[model samples]
Target: MKVKSVIVPSGMEHLTKFTRKIPSDVNVVPVTNDDSFSNIPLKILHPSKKGRGKNEDSMVLYGQFGLKSFIFMGDLDRRGERQVLQDYPSLKVNIVKLGHHGSRTSSDPNFIKQLEPELAIISAGRHNRYGHPNQETLNTLKMENIS
Candidate 1:
């Protein structure tokens, strides 16, 4: 695999430990703002403004594979979404990987309306303790008419 670099969330260097073997040439980048991988379609979009505590959902990436455009929201909450929307008012995406484990805290109504994704992908574990993919999120998707 020819990998140029591995970008990760800010303050999340510890997650790198799970990887098997990283080539010496690959530079692991931790993003603090909206940055894109040069010569690659993948990008990291930090929704939160500076000084937003921890920013666990720091590595928000807008990516494309084949002809599909999508964005991955890494546990981003409403506040983050608000900030992202405020910055990129006209942002649009074909698909959106729901953030905050589909918790109500993320995927705000106005934010979803702005993106108007053609499809919504919710990641969750079966019978998980957190009860992720909350009904409110599902209802929001339904209300938005996002498949």
Candidate 2:
């Protein structure tokens, strides 16, 4: 199936944000809390801030199909996670892609508890400088028993 639309953060251009092929007629829209994709049954959520910068505004993506649900967090920090928790109190998914590669600045314990996912994945680089997948985050995951 063709990609009908791509929802990105407000004011973000296609060229800088992506490397894939996007057809001219496909709708490229901004990410908003209220909007969601129909074809893939995915809902995109972003921080309150509109401007793009070093600030963490990771767009949390929730993809649900049939009985399985997945939450993919893109470099989201603690604040952004808090915003998500506040916005969606019932925001629990089966699988979660950890934020900021499990950096100390992300993956708050409360947030983990809320999610209560069966499996958690961290997209961390091998021996990266940032010390991704921090020990604290791992400990939190272990404490929560999120495999």
Candidate 3:
């Protein structure tokens, strides 16, 4: 299979280091808030706020497939999570990709309360350094009754 294009958050083109390894014909599409995919139901929820460093500026995506809805929070911190909650007060999802790999810096208790995701996905390595998927975060998920 061949990759056709890469959708990167606007102003974060430098983050796509893998682009150099891809075929020259592949397209790099820069996207901003509220941008929707042509072939999918996903939309960018957070603006690509530059100068905030990488983690804070990570893209926040919301999408729906069939009757299920989900949100992918890209390394967002507590402040960013609060901002997202403020932006979309009614936002709820069946699945959520927890921010910052379930670190204490992200996954605010109130944020999870508001989101009320059925399942929380944390991308962290097993027994790796940095102590990812922190116990506090896990407790928050448990308190929220999320799987």
Provide the TM-score for each candidate, comma-separated.
0.78, 0.80, 0.87
**Per-residue lDDT for 1-147 in model 2, tens only?**
888776766545334544245677788776656665556567776745464633375577888778989998888889889999998899899999999888899899999999999899999889999888899999999999989
Total clashing residue pairs per candidate? 0, 0, 0
The true-versus-predicted C-alpha distance at residue 126 of model 1, in Å, is: 1.0
**What is the C-alpha lDDT profile of model 3 across 26-94, one tens digit per residue?**
887667775777786688987545433367877899988888899999898999899999989898999
Error of 2 at 43 (Å): 0.6
Better of 1 and 2 by TM-score: 2
Residue-level error in angstroms, candidate 2, position 76:
0.9
Write the residue-wise lDDT of candidate 1 on 1-147 in tens digits. Answer: 587877666555455453436666777665666555577677667733333324445557787788888988888888888877777788899999989889999999999999989999989999999998999999999999999
lDDT of 2: 0.79
Error of 3 at 15 (Å): 4.8
Model 3, residue 63: displacement in angstroms? 1.4
Could you tell me which 10 consecutive residues in candidate 3 have the lowest summed lDDT? 46-55
Task: Mark the regions of model 2 whose C-alpha exceeds 4 Å error after superposition.
Answer: 1-6, 14-28, 53-55
Error of 1 at 55 (Å): 4.9
For candidate 1, the 10 contiguous residues with the lowest summed lDDT are 47-56
Instruction: Give candidate 1 misplaced runs (Cα > 4 Å).
Output: 1-5, 14-27, 47-57
Local distance difference test, each candidate: 0.78, 0.79, 0.84
